[model samples]
Target: MQQLSKSHIPFFVVLVLCFTPWLQSPSALVLGLILSQLGWVPTNVPIAKWTKKLLSYSIIGLGFGISLSEAFKATSSGIGLIVTTIFVTLILGTWIAIKIGLDKKTGYLISSGTAICGGSAIAAVSPAINANANQTGLALAVVFILNSVALFVFPVIGHALNLDQHTFGVWAAIAIHDTSSVVGAAGAYGEEALRTATTLKLARALWIIPVALGSAWYFGKGKQKLQIPTFIFLYIAAVVVSDLLPQFETLYHMTFSVAKQTLVACLFLIGSAISLEQVKEAGLKPLLFGVGLWLAISIGTLVWLLY
Candidate 1:
């Protein structure tokens, strides 16, 4: 068996710290980025796959902390906004990409990421469009950079605008690309915001199926199988189980708490995957397109929420 190297020790240590209360989402992300820059991330570990699994499990565990009635109300009230924003973001993103002369696949990937669930949207659409590694990597780099920024900036913007928890949650769900960042920002804001954001974001994520199928038809890759996130059904089931069995509320809360910490660790892994070379490879045009699309959605959503 291969032995653990001394160079890998720091990465393991920080990862463990991520599970503790001392390391929150933003800090964990920052630490991960630092690790990546320092070349401390272990090559043997499959960080991307691990991040995906941990995030899915954490999200499902979070369902235990939420009331199903509240989840329903949040989803129902924001259904119109979610649908509108998804379509609008895609259309606007396409336009911006064309104007900026961004690559079609890369542009669409960024737009899909912004319009839907960030990395998840990009991942689902990439295969449908038959995007090459460079194209997919560029798209993911843009979205990931923006997602990291949103984690820190959105909460500050919420406080500055004096937006209530519901408004902030909706804004985060719509504006942020990745579910992890949305949960991170909303969780920092308050419990109500976290619940609202989590429910709305997952509900929005359900659009991935139709969107992916549509992309395949549009891109003439009809044979591509869509990568649907099955965890969402499990998340819904968790909510149902939690609501129905109030007697096990304590156990549910414990699971939820553990899941939240796991999410922090997942963020760390996500951060460690982001290398300076990856950012450099993302290039200027695609990055600009991502930023512009993100700003349009973020500002537009915040204005609608405030008004």
Candidate 2:
């Protein structure tokens, strides 16, 4: 096999990723992970490093800056209804996924995608469970497929329920598995939904820091101290700094876009990591479980939002 330059693949893929319209943050992350794994992009590049640094600055300097700048602007009832829908879906999906024998690790991943952020949640949980690369890849794939469907289906369902833009945005943020999907679905409805959904999704993402740290302590007892993930700290720092300072505002925003683009490139790498020859090894069981879990969340959310 011919050897490829480290920068060559990433540079090429980055070009493609930059041009593509990533509808949501998770979509970009999924794509970035896949491409990075495939040698289609350079994972060793400074993108992740820069993002980490930027995020730290944002969190500290910016003061956990609002992800949903406009979400609070919505009517109280609309936001409450959206929150209720999300919580209900999360409970129902987790129960269903577990009842079907999905591994605890995979179950958490699916639940995170259903309940909070998508790939980020999965990434956070991976270290806690010591999830294999293939398992992570598969979980991401399942989330991606489900999110794509949610993009179209969510808007229609929201419309059918006569939900306003703010209400729909909240629903999209709460129900959609990935941030990108949330943005896409919300944007499909209107600018208000787009803004609200992004904010809501970001707020949900904040939960990962605590969850990761707790999971690390609980699960990493047998492992070496260094094995404990420190990235969560960086992620939190990033959020904090960005929210506190106005001077670094441009830097924070720049990194935000770059992070999203890098993630898209990562998705292509992840796609290559999938062992096509043995794709069926996980069998129909996990796939079926994932499907059922996804449906339960969707149906459950709809019911809560309507009733």
User: Judged by TM-score, which candidate is best?
Assistant: 2
The most accurate candidate by lDDT is 1
lDDT tens per residue, model 2, 1-307: 3345854665465546643564344455455555544556444444434433333333232223434333334424355644554455456655776687666566656665566577666666665556655666677777878887888898888888788887788668766887768888898899988988777776666666656565566556766673545566666667656655657877777676566544444444444445544446667655676677667666665566567
Worst 10 residues of 1 by lDDT: 221-230
Model 2: residues with Cα > 4 Å off, grouped in runs: 1-99, 221-227
TM-score of 1: 0.65
Clashing pairs in 1: none
